[model samples]
Target: MRKFWSKFKREDGQVMIIFAFAMVVLIGFAALVIDVGTVQVAKRRMQTAAEAAALAGAQDLPKTAEAISAANTVAKLNGGSLIRTTVKAPYQGNSNQIEVICTINVQYSFARILGFTDTDVSGRAVAQKNPQWAGEALPFLNLDDDYLANPKIVAWEKTAPGDFESLWPDDYNVYFGGKFDDHSKTYFTVDFADGITVTKGTVATVKQEIGYIYGQKKPVYIFSLSSAVIKSGKYNNIKNKDVVPLEDLVLLQVTFDSFDEQDKNLFLTTTKVFDINKGEYPTDYLTSPGGTSATIVE
Candidate 1:
């Protein structure tokens, strides 16, 4: 009898108790693995959606109403919703930056049995738009001091009448890469050589080619050739020229008046860019605001 009692005490009959505790711990580990993976997937999806939202918003910088509307639309399509947003025009000192926040609810499977059914997942993203962009240059002589009057197309002829004189295409070939007769605005831009110079006498050739369409917009980049106006490029010595340079860049809106095929002459009107730099309103807008590139900052 004493031996039986001693053996019973040694066994302790704790197998069921140990197994109950171990089962609880094992279920917790399984839940951690499975639920953690589910949450992570949700987080990744939300992050992508946030990124898309931020990019959409960045496209319309300074236009907060339009930016927010675009961001929300993209977020909904990407299986997430934007919770908060921030816009910084002239963001980070130069580029226009936009930040988007998004969130999602991840449902738990095995973790539901442990009293945790779902969790809220969130993500954030940021994007920036460059303030400066490159544009084709007029490659001509400066018109006047008046901001209203820009490049002088044929010695101060905003709208010239009578017979046109055929222009020498060789001088303008550097500015117009292809056939100019198409009259298509698509050919308005020309990529210049890195070291090319354009001053008053820089273009020694008289030019003509292609036909200019009336009212067609010939947007070009304008720069100050006067060292007095721009202190940075005083060494270039290229005065009385109209062109796009790295320094003192400005935006010019060029519009053609009329062209006579027989006369072989060109006429156009150009004005300062303040009216179109997203309007004349006070903002961090540069001379020209539309750029071709965008990037994700965060």
Candidate 2:
């Protein structure tokens, strides 16, 4: 028994066991540090790539296909492959909004020894054009004035007055000038020289033929000449009673067209009167009125 105890105390091979246990702990800690560092670096790179891709996409939102292509290019250049890209336009009356999202896949290299082969990283970005950027400049004139005349009453006619060829030779001119005018205001008006007795208090209907060169064609209506009145004022009394008072008639319909960025045109048709009393005459018919005052009678 004494000899067995001495042999056991000799500590043969104890150091090897301790050394093996220490090595295992160190290796595990080293693996954690290295793998975690690698993942963090890859994640940062992916995030950057995604941000660049999303911004590139948004800049081309007006051209949806081009935007997607741009995003993918940006992702690839950043050492990441684009996994997904999505672009959404304005919806639900939010006309000024856009959304873009980009995702990328980042593969891991040194961390694979520990079984982490790859990591998925993603990012998103949104952008919108400032509303102020949409406003466009256009030349406009009140149709109520003679400047709209073939020989602009105010401006010299660059050409002969009655020469139909020299008349304001544009579709837009015919559009706005078709309406009637009083003083500086313009109103939709039609003349019925057919001896139609449009009673002052009675409802009267008038029709005007407005022709368009694009899209759709339709006739607009002006209702209830009940508000129509006769105005008599003296500028220099014309020798004959034949000169009609400016207030005697009311123009009530207006038409116009708007062009978008792509040069696509949209037509607008509107009514001219808000309300009319049984015997009340329309006081003014020359000035442009608010849309609220007119109903879309077409």
Candidate 3:
């Protein structure tokens, strides 16, 4: 028994056993580190790819299949595969939102020695569409009986001679106001039968040339003329050179008379012209305190 005890207590080869145990621990720890790091990197890549794809998809959501294609393309570019994609439209508006899921399968090199295979990396992203006028009210023009009561009488000329005699009666007061500022070159001409009495009031008309200079797609003017105002008017041959480039031009003629108080419809006629190079105008006119019109006369 003493001999057996002596042999058992011997320190020979004890260090070798300890070294083998430590090597096993170190190898296990290294395998864990390798597997965990690989998964983290793959996760990051999946997240970045998903986000970009989702944003691109949201732009065309609720309209076309282009969005799904875009998302898949982005995911593939980032070394990930798109698992699924979905898009939903707003309940009461034109906006839409999208969501995407992506996955990557990564295999560990050194960790495989420890019975580890491949790890799954996944990420999700969401996005939405935005409108042009999301939170603001649009502007419009307003006309009522009060507008015509203070009508400004500008000269009226016939495009061709003998178009017709003046329709306004002379008893209606015809007030010839001074010419608009040089900026307002389009003059208004009034033709009325004899004995018409136009009371002293402000007559308003939109300046013709001013609209052109402003470079607005749809240009309109509002003016008023007061009573008992007249000045010597000379006819000047105005050339079309003063015309400014515009997408659209419109003229609204409103006449107010003694019966204007009872008349609800005061608009006479509206003239509209379109220029292709000027740019496309909104299909619908903006409405403000004034009013909004769906269609403009062409």
Candidate 4:
């Protein structure tokens, strides 16, 4: 009986108890790693969705409803079911700024053992519209400063008689890549290698501008060009130029009103010109607040 009591008091099973406790700790550490990894992935997904939603929303800045709608659409498209989205315009007292916040939930794997079903993750992005951009190329130029006179307008015309230009096949082959049967009416833009100045009512300018449209396969912004940069061996100087809008001396953004072929040569509509730095606004005419873009301010 004494031997039996001694055996019972012995530390023979202590290792098993220690091992059990250690296993609990080990399982906890594994769970921690898994939960942390899952949360990290969730955070990344949320961040991506947030950025996409923010960009989409910023495209329609100052229009709260439209911005929210676009944000939601992009968030879902990015595979993140948003828990919330906030669109704030005039962010930080800057009328050109827009902000978007997105939130999502992450389901737990081994974390469920710790009584956690899911964790919430959130990401925020801020976008701003700037009035200036450098290096990006423009395929179209405004005939006049009508866009500046009324920056709210989304459609405009030269209001002068000219031949209807076809944009498909030829222009697409030259400037825009991947030719499809686009029957869009083509308008003339500043074809000058230097965007600083222009000669009014110059047929040579029109022809040169048309040549620009046909010269490059794709119009892209070149942000690396220095002020002294030479293109085609010609120095691009924007120091002082008459007839060029003070705002457009650096760059221009022009979008045609439609892809449909128009036989008419002259028309007057809202200004279709915007800054390349500012993203393309909706063509639906949502009352543009003037010159906007998507930039992360925060």
Candidate 5:
């Protein structure tokens, strides 16, 4: 019995057993760290996908079908599997908001030792399409005299200089005719229904077809209304001779009557009421429908 007891107290194999246990613990900790990091990466990827999809959808608000298509396309492009999406447009009375959720399956690199094959990660985002003051209206000055109700021949020929932006007519005009006496603040930008062809790129436009052109009368619900202190465009050096063909005029839209080359004036019929809200591009407008721009508010 004494001999057996002495043998039992021997340290043989004890160290190997302890070392094996320690190695197993250390490996477990290392594996856990790797798996956690991989999952975090997957979560970030999912978040990116969600945000991209939401923004894409928000741009096409009010149009349900178009918004859905845009969101799906962006999700696939960003490598996220879209789980679901909800959109709230102005018509739906949610202030035009959109939400996107995406997910991803992250395969565990080291956690497989623990029988954990993979984990699912997800992310979500929301966006909104807010109403903005449209700057894209025809070049009409706000008059307190209540003259819009009367069809007036607003002449820009002799009273106004052919203020050309060095000949590259901007898609919109922002010309300033001197100080606040400024009988009229020249601001024009709009998406007219027809009778005008707009080339976003610079096109050699004839002066006759541009600046002083006329067309049939149309109802302009959204007219331009700007304040006294807005950013002004420079038309200093351009002269009448400079208004020759080949000179570009990126005019937004101007169609009031048939091309009566004889009379170069805008005869417009208008309404007095408007939905006053936020203006686009740091605006102070009384009437400029395109004042608002697209942005994420969620």
Candidate 6:
């Protein structure tokens, strides 16, 4: 009995058994880290796709079919197939609000061993169409007051330096006179002296406004002369009409095509106002009834 007890106390093979158990635990931790990291990468990709889709759809708000088509195109471009999407036009009865929900399936790399073959990811965004030009806008004004009531394509002609100074003198005619004063003529000129009411009232501010419009290649909404009431047909009267320069202009919106410095001509791309309340804009016109803007909500 004493000899049997001595043999039973031997520690042979004990270290091997402990090492085997430790190896299994270490392997499991490695799998968890690798799989989790892969999923995180896929989640980020899905998020990017969702944001792009939402912005694309928002640009075509109020039009159910067009909005969906635009969203799908953007999702596909981002390398992920859209699993599902929800588009709400005029969200919450607001004509300008557009909401979009996007979902995608993300494949797993190392998670298959844990029975998670793939995971689903989702993203959402909301965009609003501004009702009108809110603040600082391009300085160009429309040719006729009638353009404000009904927006359409209008052409602008450049005035010779001599003619520009003669038509819009600084002393007598402080305001730059163009199509707004001469309905019979289509020719126009940039009245640098009193062309626009700069919000900042600085030379830099004036240059900024002009530079923005001149540099734009895409169609965008800008303030036109039609937006102004133009009482007594002068600039001094502009201050009394409760209108803010570069802010309030009945010329709610205008789309520019090209500004030719040499020929001195300004052209418009297109001007069609169907459901002016929810219509399409030129180059997705300035975000009102025919405009678009996007933001991520979720």
TM-score ranking from best candidate downward: 5, 1, 4, 6, 3, 2
Instruction: Please report, in order, the local distance difference test score of every candidate based on alpha carbons.
Output: 0.51, 0.36, 0.39, 0.46, 0.47, 0.47
- Give the runs in model 6 whose Cα sits over 4 Å from its true position: 1-16, 82-99, 107-110, 131-291
lDDT (C-alpha) at residue 269 in model 3? 25
Q: What is the lDDT of candidate 6?
A: 0.47
- Tens digits of per-residue lDDT for model 6 on 98-210? 66666667676555655667777666666664333222223444433345354554433322222110111121111122325432211122233223432211112233223
User: Residue 200 deviation, candidate 2, in Å?
Assistant: 52
In model 1, which residue pairs have backbone atoms overlapping below 3 Å?
163-263, 164-263, 164-264, 167-207, 167-208, 168-207, 180-210, 181-210
Give all TM-scores, in the order shown. 0.51, 0.37, 0.41, 0.49, 0.55, 0.46
Write the number of the candidate with greater TM-score, choosing between 2 and 4.
4
Write the residue-wise lDDT of candidate 4 on 1-298 in tens digits. 9999778767668877988899878878888898888788777877787788777777676666777788778878884454666666657876556676677777887767768788788777777654433223332333333344443222112323331111112121122222351212122222333333432232332343333333332322211111222122222222212323333323323322332113222222332333333443223322122223567667
| Candidate 2 stretches greater than 4 Å from native | 1-12, 79-113, 126-131, 134-298
- What lDDT does candidate 5 reach at residue 87? 35
Prediction 4 global C-alpha lDDT: 0.46
**Best candidate, TM-score:** 5
- Which residue runs does candidate 1 get wrong by more than 4 Å? 1-13, 80-95, 134-187, 191-219, 222-290
Per-residue lDDT of model 2, residues 247-298, tens digit only = 3322223334432223222233443433322333244322232111111111
Q: Is candidate 2 or candidate 5 better by TM-score?
A: 5
| RMSD (Å) per prediction | 9.4, 17.3, 17.7, 11.5, 11.2, 12.1
